[model samples]
Target: MVASIKSAGKLSESSIRSQDDLEKVVEQEQPKKKWRWRVDTSDAPKEIFNRTLYLSILVFGVLGSARGYDEGNISGTLAQVSFKKTFGLSDPHKSKDEVANLKSNIAAMVQLGSIGGSLLAMYTVDRLGRIRALQQVCIIWIIAAIIQITSKNVGQLYAGRLIEGFAIGQTTTIGPLYTAEVAPPQIRGMCGCIFAGAVYFGIMMGYFANYGTALHMLNTSQVQWIAPTSIKIVLAGLIFIGSFLLCVESPRWLVKVGKVELAAQNLSKIRHLPPDHPYIVGEVADINELIAIEQEAISGSGVFDKIREILTVKSVRYRFFAVATMSQLLGQWSGANAVTIYSPELMGFAGYKGVERLKMTAVLGVVKFISAYASAFFIIDFLGRRKALYTGITLQMISILFFAIFVTVVPNATEDVPLPLTASEDRAAKAALASLYLSGVGWTMGFNSIQYLLGSEIFPLRIRSFAQSAIMVLHFANQYGNSKALPKMLLSMHKFGAFYFFVGIMAISLFWAWFFVPEVAGRSLESMEDIFSLPWYMIGRKGAELCPDHSEVSKIHVNSSGHGNAYDGKLDYDEKTSVHHDEGNSLMVKDSNEKDLEKEVKK
Candidate 1:
C-alpha cells in the first residue's frame, strides 16, 4: 500500500486545466484484508541497529542528562545546612515562613525562565537548525554553571538557576524531536523514549553529586557548597562537544529549506544507506513532495502567518496541536516535578529529616531514573504510548489521592508543620512516602517519556520545530505554575490539599488521553498529514493497512513513474509481513499539455 500522498500542491493548482491529472488523482482502495501484524522495523535493514544509530540516540541522552543534572541537583542542595546558611534561606534571623517563601522563589524561578526559553526556541530552532540550537543551549548551560559556582547570595544563585532553566527548556524541546526524526520507524519509540530516561539519568547524577557534596560540605566553607553546581559544567561541556562532533542536521529540516540534495546525502550518511537505496530514495522523494504541500499551506514569510496556519487548519489543529498540548498538560499535572525537584523538603514534611531526608530524595531520584530507563529501553515499544500512559496516569492518580489522605490525617497535621518523631507519625509518614515513590514508577515510566515522544511525532517538516517549541513553552508554563504553586501550596494549604488538587487534574487528563491520543508508533513522519486526513476515530484502530494483491497491480497504467508519486506503505501496511511496501498511489496527470506545461516552465 503506497501511503505517501500525491503532489498535493500541483494537484490543487492545476486541477481545472487537466483531465488526465484528474484520473491520476483517483485514490484506489481495496477492502480491508486479514493481514497479520509485525513490527515496523521488519522493512528496515538490520544495519538499522548499528553503532551510528545507537550513538545518535545515546547522544540525546547526553542532552537529557545535562537537563536532569540541573533539575535533580537542587533537591540535594536544599538538604545541605551550609547551602541554606550561606544563602540566608535558613539563616537564624529568618522566620520559618520567610524561609519557605524564599525557597519557593529560588526553586520556581528556574521554571519561569524555562518558559521563556521554550518560547524563544519556537523561532530559533526552526531558523538555526537542531544541531546549532543544541550548541547554543550548551553554551548557555556553561555560562549558567559558572555563575552558580561563583554565587554568594540567593539572588545570584537565582540568576544562574533561571539561565540554566532557560537552557534546559530548549534541550528538552529539541532532544526528542531530533530523536524521532532520526530513528528508524521500528525503534523510533524506544530511541525517542531515551530522551526522557537520559533526563532522569541527569537527575540521578545531580542528586548523587549533591549527596556527595553534602557529606563533605554540609556545614563547611561556603565555597565547598559550590561542588554540585560545578558538575553542570562538565555535563554541559560534554554536550557542547557532542553537538558539533556527533550529530548531523535533521534531513527533514533540510528538505523543508529546499536543500534536497543535501538532505539525501544526510539521509544516506545517517541511515548508512546508499543514496539510491530504495528506502532512502523513497523517503527523500516523499519528503520533497510533502514539504511542497506544507510550504503551500504554511508560509514562512512571517511568524504570524505560520502561527495562523497551524491554528486555522483542522488537521494541524486537532491532530498535532491539541494532542501535543494535552500530553504536555499531563506532564505538568502528573505531580512528578513536585517530587523530583523538591523531594527533600517534600519528604521532610513526612517526618524524615537531616541526612536521612536527603538520602531519601536521592532514592526517589533513583526510582525516577530507573523508571525512565526501563521505559526508554523496554516498555515503550511493546506497550506503546497509549497503554503506557493509561496505566501510568491511573496509578498516579490513585497514589496522589492516597498521599493526600494520609498526610491530612496524620496527627495534628497543619500547614507548614514539620512531621514529628512519634511512632504513629512515623508510620503515617512512611505510608505516604511509599505512595509517593510508587507513583514515581508511573510518572517516570509513562507521563515523562510519552509526552516528549508524542510532541516529536505529531508535527510536519515545515513547522515541526516551531510547533514543538510552542508545545514545550506551554509545557514549561505549566511546570512554572506547578513550581510556583507547589512550594507555597504545600506550606499554605492543608497538608494534603495539594495532592487532592493534583488528583482532580490527573483524572481529567487520563480521560482526555483515552479519547484523543492516537497511536503513531511506527508511522512515517511524512505520512502524518495523510493519517490526520481521515477521521480521528479511525486513526489508531486502523492497523497496518494492506496493499492490494499483486494481481491488482498489472491492470493499472501509470504516467510518470516519479519518486513523489507513491503512497507510504504505513497506511496500507500488511501486518503479516514486516516489510514497508510502497504502492505508487500518487495523483499523476496524463497530458502533453501538462507535460508541455512542465517543459515550458523549464524553458
Candidate 2:
C-alpha cells in the first residue's frame, strides 16, 4: 500500500498541475458508465475509522446527552408528585397560571444560564482548546448536579439548574465543533451528526429513567425525581474521564494557534498514518493555507478585530447570518425544543394520563433517537444536507399542521386540565399523539441535527469558535423564550394556537432554507470558503455548483491495464498504482478501475 501510494504521489507531482489536469487524466484513463444515486463514502480512507477516532467521537458526542437529559428529564421531574410538593408546585392555593409560571421559570433557567455559558465558551474554546473546555463543562455540570440533588427548596433547585445550563451551553458549542474538526471529510456528515444523535440517546435515557422511577417507586417518593436528576452526574463523570483517557485535541484547533507541527502530529495520529504520508501532509497543508489566508485578511490580532472581521467581511458576514443566525433562530422557533422539553405535557394533551404520559414521552424519545441516527447513517449524506433539511422540515410542517387541526376541532384537553374524552375524541387524541411523534422524527432529521452540524462546519476556523458560540447564544436564548412562554402560550393562546404558530414559523423556515441553505454534504472544512465565495444572493443557488469539487478528491483508483492508475492517498489498490497530490488546491485523485471507471464516466 505504501509503495502504491508513493508511486501515485510521484505521478501526481509530475503530471497533475490543476483540477482540470486531474479530471482530464481521469477521463482519459477510465471507461464510460451509468449514474445512480447513493451515499458516497469512496473518498474516506478505512484508517480514518480507527477505534481511536470512534472512541474520541463517542467521548465528545456523549456530552450531548447532558443537554438532552436536561430537556427530557425536567418535564417528568416537574410532574412528579413528590417533586411538585418539594418545590411548592403542588400547593392547593396556587392557580394554574401560578403553577405554569413556576414551571416556566424552572425550565427556562438552564437556557438563561446557557446564554452566559455560550459567551464564556467563546473565550474558553479558543484559549483552553476543545477537550479542555469540555472537561471544564463536565466539572461545572457535576457541581450543578450535586446542587440539584441536595436542594431543599425551589430557589436552590433553580440555582442548580442555572449552573447546569451554563455547562450544557458550553457542550452545545464545543462537542459538535470538535467532532467536525476531527472527522475525515468523506464521512464528516455522519460523524458530525453523532453529537446530535447522542442528544436523543440522552433523551431516551432520561425518559426511561423517569418511567422506571415512576413505575417502581411511589410518585410521592422524593427518590423518584432525585434518581433521574442524578443521572447527570454519571454522564458528566464519564465525559470528564474520557476527555483525559480517550480523546485528543482537535488538530484544526492545534493548527489555528500556530502549532502546525503539533497539528500535523495529532492529525497523523488520528488518521492512523505516518506524518510524512502524502494524505496527512496534504491535509495539514490545506489547514495551513486556509488559516494563513484568514489571518492575512484580518487587520489585527485582537479579539475585537476577529469580531469585526465577521461583520466587515461580506462572505463571512453573510455566512454569519444565513447559516449561523437564521438556522438557530428558525430551528428553535420551529417549536421542536418545546416538544422535546415538554413531551410529557404534550402527551397529556394527547390524552395519555399519568404514567402513560411518561411512557408516551419515552416513545417520542425513541422515535427521535432512531430518526436522528437514520439521518446520520443514511439521510444527510445520501440525500445531501439541503434535501435532508427540505424533507425533514416538510415532515415537521405536515405533522404540526395535522396536530393543530386536530386540537382545533376536538375538545380532548386544556392547558389547565385533562378532559375525559369521548370515544372519537380519544381516537383523535391518538392521531394527535402520532403527529407529535412524527414531528419529533422530523425535528431530529432536520433542524435538530443540521443546526449543530452547520454551526460546527460552516464558519472559517478563525471565526468558528466565536461564530458557534454566538449561534449557541441565539439557540439558548430562543429556547429560553419559547420554554418560558410555552405554558402561558398553551393556556392563553389555546392549545391549538401554539401548533399553528409553529406551522407558520416552519413555513418561513422552509422558504428561507430553500433560498439560503447550501448543500455541504461531503465538502472539507478548508474548502468551505469556495462555497461562501459567491455573492450573498448567489451563494444558496450556485455555491455548491461553483465551489471547487473537493468531494471526489480522496478517490482511489486502479485500472485493469495496471498503467496510469491515479491515487488520492487512500490505500485501495488492485495493483501498483500512481497517486496524485495537487498540493496547491489540496486535490487528491486516483485513476478509475473498470468499476470505478464506469461509475465515474456516467457522471
Candidate 3:
C-alpha cells in the first residue's frame, strides 16, 4: 500500500509495505551533507536548537552557582582579619595547632552537611519530581544563608554552613541529571558542560565578592564577611524564581511515571516539533521500549529489587563502579577541590601575602571559568570525552609535579607567616604559582567538566536518581576528607609531600580512564545500553565499532493510511523484537512473516 508521511507541514508519498521499505524511506529523508561547526550535528534537526531549550538549560545551569559561591567565598572569608578576631582565631592563648583544627572544622562543615544532603536527595528526587526537589533545595539554601549572615558567634556560623551544605549536595545531584534528560543527543555534551561551567562561574563571582568586600569594607566590622556570605541568598532566590517561570519537568521522568501523553507534549515543546513528527514519535517510542525492557529484565518494582539488579547485572554494575563511583572519587582526590577551598592559603604558601593573595585567587577563578567554557565550546564535543580526559589529566599531572619540585627545593617556613626568600627562591615561588593556575586550567578542561556529564548520562532511568545520589554522597565525602586533611597534610606530610601524593593519584587516574572510560560524546541516553553491552574489557576501546547508532537498530514505520501514526520497531538484548505504538493512537501490526528481519545485524 502507498504511504503518505507528513513532516514539517510537507507530505510525501511512498510505498512502505515491509520493514525494509520503511528503512529506505527514512534514510532518504535524512540530510545527505554533514554539517560541521566545531562539532557535527548532522543527525540533529535544526529545530532542536530552539530558544526554549537554551533558556531551560540556562535556568537549570545556574543551580550550580550555589556550590561555586560557597567554595569560592568561604576560603577568603575565613582569611579576613575581622573574621578571625570574631571567631576566636585571633586568641593569643590558642596554639597554632589548635587554630588549625578550628579552621579545618569551620571550612569542612558544609561538606559534612552535604553528605546528609546527598542521602536525602536519594529519597526526595524520585518521590518528588526534579523541579520540586530543586525548589526545596533553594528554600533551604536561603534559610541557611540568612543564618550565616546573622551569625554572632562561631557555633552559629558552623550551623549555617552545615545547613547550606544540604542544598549544595542536592543541586549537584539534580542539576546535571535534569540537563542531560532535556538536552538533544547532538548537543548533550555541550549542555552538560554548562553545569560544570556554572560551577566555575559561581566560584568567580564568590572570589570577586570577597575581593570587593575586603577591598572596600572595613576590616574590623563583621560586614566584611557578612556581605560576601549574602551572595548565596541572592543566587538561591534567583534560581527558585526561575524554576517556576522558565523551567519545565523532565520528559524522561514523565514517561517513567506512566504519563505518556504529558511526556510527548513536553518533549515536543523542548524539541520544537509537532507531536506526530517522526523525530518526536521515534524518541518517545525509544524511551518506552527501553523502560519496558529494563522492567522485564529485573521483574520486580521494589527498591531492593533495583539495588539487587544493579549489583547482579554486569553492565549496570560496571556503569556504577567504573563510570559513576570512580569519577567522583578520583575527581575529588585530584587535589583541585583543595586548591579551590584553600586558594588564599595556597597563595600564602607560594609567598603572596594579604590582599595580593586575594587578587591572585580572583585571577585563579577567572582562569578556571574561562577554561571550563572553552572546553564546552571547543574541546569537549570536538575531541570527544576520552581524549579530553587524556589531555586535561596530563596537563594536571605536569603542573602538580612541577609545583611539588619547586616547594621541595624551597620550603615555606610557615603558611601563616611569609618568610624572606633568596633571589633564586623568589623565581621558584612565582613559577610555582603559575603551575597552580595551569593545574586549574587542566582540571576544568578534563575531570571537572566530564565527571558531571558522565555520571548523569551513563545510568538507566529506573535507578538514575539512586545511583546519582550515591555518587554525590561519595563526592561530598571525599571533598570533606580533603578539605579537613589538607592543612594537616601540608604540615605533617611537608609542603611537597601532599602534592606528591596528588601527583601519584593523578597518574593512576589517567591510566584508569584510558582502559575503562568509553567515548559517549554523540550517543543518545537510550542507546547507552548498546555501548555497555559489549565485553567489559572492550567497551573503552571497541564500543563505537561494535555498536551501531540507534537509528540503524530501531526503525520507525509510518502508517500507509496517513493518520500520522508511527510504529516503533526495536531490538532488545536477547534479540527479541518489541513494537511500541506512538501515543497509543495506532493499531499494532503483525510481522509474523518477517520475524528475523527485526534482529540487528551483528558485526
Best candidate (score: TM-score): 2
Weakest lDDT window of 10 consecutive positions for candidate 2: 569-578
Error of 2 at 303 (Å): 2.7
Each prediction's TM-score against the native?
0.82, 0.89, 0.88
RMSD of each: 9.8, 5.5, 6.4
> RMSD to the native, candidate 1?
9.8
Q: lDDT tens digits, residues 292-326, model 2?
A: 77778775866798778888888888888877799
Candidate 1 residue runs with Cα over 4 Å from true position: 1-40, 299-301, 412-428, 535-603
**202-306, model 1: which lDDT tens digit per residue?**
888888877776666637666545877788888878877876677878888787676778887888888886675555665665666666666676546467876
Residue 154, model 1, lDDT = 79
- lDDT of the candidates, in the order given: 0.70, 0.82, 0.82
**244-363: candidate 3 lDDT, tens digit per residue:** 988888999999999989998999898897776656766888888889888887678667887797799899999988877888888899999999998998888788888888999999
TM-score winner between 1 and 2, please give it: 2
